[model samples]
Target: MKYSARLRLLAVQTGLIASLGLGFATLAYSETILTVALAANPQMQTAAKLIGNFEKKYPDIKVRFQTLPENQLRPAVLKDVATKSGQYDVVMIGAYEVPLWAQKGWIVDLSQYAKADTAWNEGDLLRPIRNLVSYKGNLFATPFYGSSSFMFYRKDLFAKAGLTMPETPTWNQVAQFAAKLDDKKAGVSGICLRGVPGWGQNLASLTTVINTFGGRWFDQKWQPALSEPESKAAINFYVNLIRQHGQPDAAKDGWQECLQLFSQGHAAMWYDDTVFAGPVLDQAGPGVKDNVGFAMAPVKATKASGWLWAWGLSIPTTSKNRDAAWKLISWLTSQEYIKLAGEKAGWGQVPPGSRTSTYQIPEYKKAVASFGDLTLQSINSADPLRPTIEPVPYSGVQYVDIPEFEQIGDFTSQQISGAISGQVTVDEAINASQKKMTDIMQDAGYIK
Candidate 1:
C-alpha cells in the first residue's frame, strides 16, 4: 500500500474511534426522565420543592412535574391512564380515586414493592389512609399526606366579638358566630368556605353538611334523596351561609382561594381540609400563626362530620418505568422524606396525617403543636361507612364512591354554584340536582 493511503486510513480509524467514544460518553450520562402529574396544592408544592433531594440522590433519574389545578388534574390523569397512554410514570391521586383505579387495574400494585422495602415501613402509615388507598388487600398507592375536614377560626376575632369557639362546634353556633363577626367594611368576611363548582370543591363541604342534617344521597332502596326535606334544608343553609357572609365572589372560591382569604386575614373562619394548617401557620401572613385555632367540623345530627381524604402517589400500569416509579414513590413517601421536609421546608410545613411516625417527630410536633393531635383525631373519627344519619346504599363521607358520582357531583355543583351566585334559587338548584341525580342513578343501574 502507498504511504499516503496508509496515513488516510489511520486518520479515518481515529475519527471513527473518537465518534464511538463520544457515543459511549453520552450513554453513560443520559438520565431516565420520569414524568409526574401532581395536583396543585400547598402540600404538593412543598413536595415539589423538596424533590431536589431525590434527584440528587439518584443522579441517574430525573423528574419532571406537571402540576395542575384540582379540577383539571383529575380528568387529565383519568384520560391518560384509562387510554393506557404512557404519558406519566407517576400520578398524584386521592383516596377517592385509588380503589376505583386499582380495581380496574389501571394502577400498578405497590404492595409487593412496599413489602420488599422493609425500610419503607408500610406499617408506619396511618391505618385509615393505608386502607383507603388499598383494593382487595393490595396497596396501590402510598400517601404523601392525608387530611380530614375541620374548622379554623381566628382566636382574636372570636375573643373581640365576645364569642368562644367550642372544640366541637355545632353548625347553628357557627352561624350565630358568623353573624356577629362579619365585618365586610373592615375587609374581612365572616367566614370562608369553598363555593367553586367541582366534586372536590364546594360539594365536599356541602355533602358533610347534608350528612349532618340527616340527609343521604340515596335512601335504603337506592332512590335519589337530594330533594328530601333534610337534604333541601342542608342545601339551603349552606348556600345562604356563604351568600350572606362568605368571602367576596364566594361562588368562585374553592379550597385554595378560601385558604388564601383566611391565611391573609381576609376571612375570620374557614371550614375545609386539615392540611390547611401547615400552609396557614408557616407560610401565611404575619399574625396568622399565632391566632389560628382549630375545631372539629361543626355538627348537627351526627357526633362527627369530618371527611377522610389522602393525596397519594400511584404508578400507572401503562408506565414503562414501573420499577423506577416505585423507587421514587417509596422514597418520597418514606419517613426519611418526611424528616427532610421538616428540615428543609420548616417543621410547621412538613407533610401531615399520613404516618404515625410523623407525629412522633419532635420538630413536627412542636411546629404544629396547636392542631396536630386534632388533625389525627378528625381523620380517625370520620366514618365513611356510615357518613349519613339515614341508611344509604353507598359508602363515603364527602363523596359517593361510585364512578358515576364524579359526573353527578359535577352537575350538582354547577346548579349549586348558580344558587350561590344568585343566578338560581336554592330550591331550583336542589330540584334540578335531584332530577339529574335520579336520571344518573337510573342510567347507572343504581336504581330502576
Candidate 2:
C-alpha cells in the first residue's frame, strides 16, 4: 500500500508540471497584433516593403494593414476615432486633419515620443510640413510623404506636334495645348484630371484651381464665396476642360485613375502631386518615362499656384498599442528607412518633401535631377496662409482648415461632380455649394 501511494503522488506531480509548462509556453510565444489603417497609394507600397523588415526586427509584434481608397479612408478613420472604437492603432492622415483632430482630443500628442527618442531627429523634418502637422507647438503626427502640385507632360507628343511647353504655363496656355494635342482616335486624351466626387479627391486639385483663379472659400467675414463670379468662372473652366479633352469616363477618375491613364500613355498631360514624378519615371512601368517633362502647376491670377500637402501617420488616443504604433511610425519615417527605400525601391521612389536630408542624398539628387529643383521650388513657394489671390479666413492651400470644412467640402464636391457629369449646370452646382457652405458656417458660428 505504501509503494502504490508513492507511485500515485509521483504521477500527479508530473501531470501538474506538464500542464504548467504548456501554459507558460503559450504565454511566451503569443504576439501582440497591431492594426494599421492607411490609404491605398504608391507610398503604401514602400511601406509594405518596410513592414517585412519591421517584423523581422520585432518578432513579438505582428502588423495587419487595412488599406482603403482616399475617399473611403477619411470617413472610416474618422468614424473609428470619433466613436473611440479602438479599431485602429495607427492611421495615415493628412496635414489638414492633424491639427483639427488633435484639437478634438482624438489623436495623441506625439511630441512625447519625439522627445523621448534621442535618434528621432525631429529637426530633420521640413519646417513647412512639420508646422502643418503640429498644433500650438506640439507635434501631432509624423509626415511620411509631402508634396506640391505640378504639371507632367509628354515631351515626345509635344515634339511631334511641334509645340514647346513653358517652364511656367498658364491655364489658358494649357487649354490651348490640350486642344492641339487631343487625339481621340489615337487612343490618347489631351489631359487627365481627378473627377471623383470626394473632398480629398477632386476638390483637392479643384481648390487650387479656385485659388489661382482669384477665388477664396470664404471672405474676410467668413461668408461663402462659391457663387461669386471668380469661383463660378473657375468651376466652369475646369468642368469644360475635362469634358472636352479629358479621358473617357473622366467623372469617375481620381488620383489613381489619372496616374494610370497618364502612365499608360492614355493621356498627354497630367497635373497632380509632385510625388508622382517617381512612378511616372519608373523604368519598370509601361510609362513614357524617357520622354516625360515637368512644369509648375498652371496658374491664372496668382503666381503661387501649387498646393501643399503631406500624408502622415498618427496614433489615436484610443489606441491600445501606442508604443508599437510609434515604433512603426518612427521606423518608416526615419532617415535610415529613406536610405533603405532608395536602395531597394530605387532612388526615384524615395518619399520626397519630408526631410531636408533626403535632398542631400547624392544618389537621390542624381536620380531626380530632372525635376528635383522644380519640385523643391514648388513646395517652398506654396504659401497656405495666402493661398488665394484674395484674402481668405482659412489657412490651407487645397482645403479649409476648420473641422466643419470636411462636411462642407464633401457636399460641395458632390454638387461640382454633378456639373462635371452634365447632370447639373455649373451655375446650379455653384449655387448649391454656396448654400451648403453658408448653412455649415452659420451653424458652426463662423458666420451669423
Candidate 2 lDDT over residue span 150-231, tens digit each: 9999999999999999999999999999999999999899999988888888898899999999988899999998877888
TM values, all candidates:
0.96, 0.95
Alpha carbon lDDT at 81, candidate 1: 97
- Candidate 2, residue 213: Cα displacement in angstroms equals 1.3
What local lDDT score does residue 219 receive in model 2, on the 0 to 100 scale? Answer: 92
True-vs-predicted CA distance for residue 196, candidate 2, Å: 1.4
State the local distance difference test value for candidate 2: 0.90
Off by over 4 Å in 1: 2-23
lDDT of each: 0.91, 0.90
Worst 10 residues of 2 by lDDT: 280-289
RMSD vs true structure, all candidates: 1.8, 1.9
The model with the greatest lDDT is 1
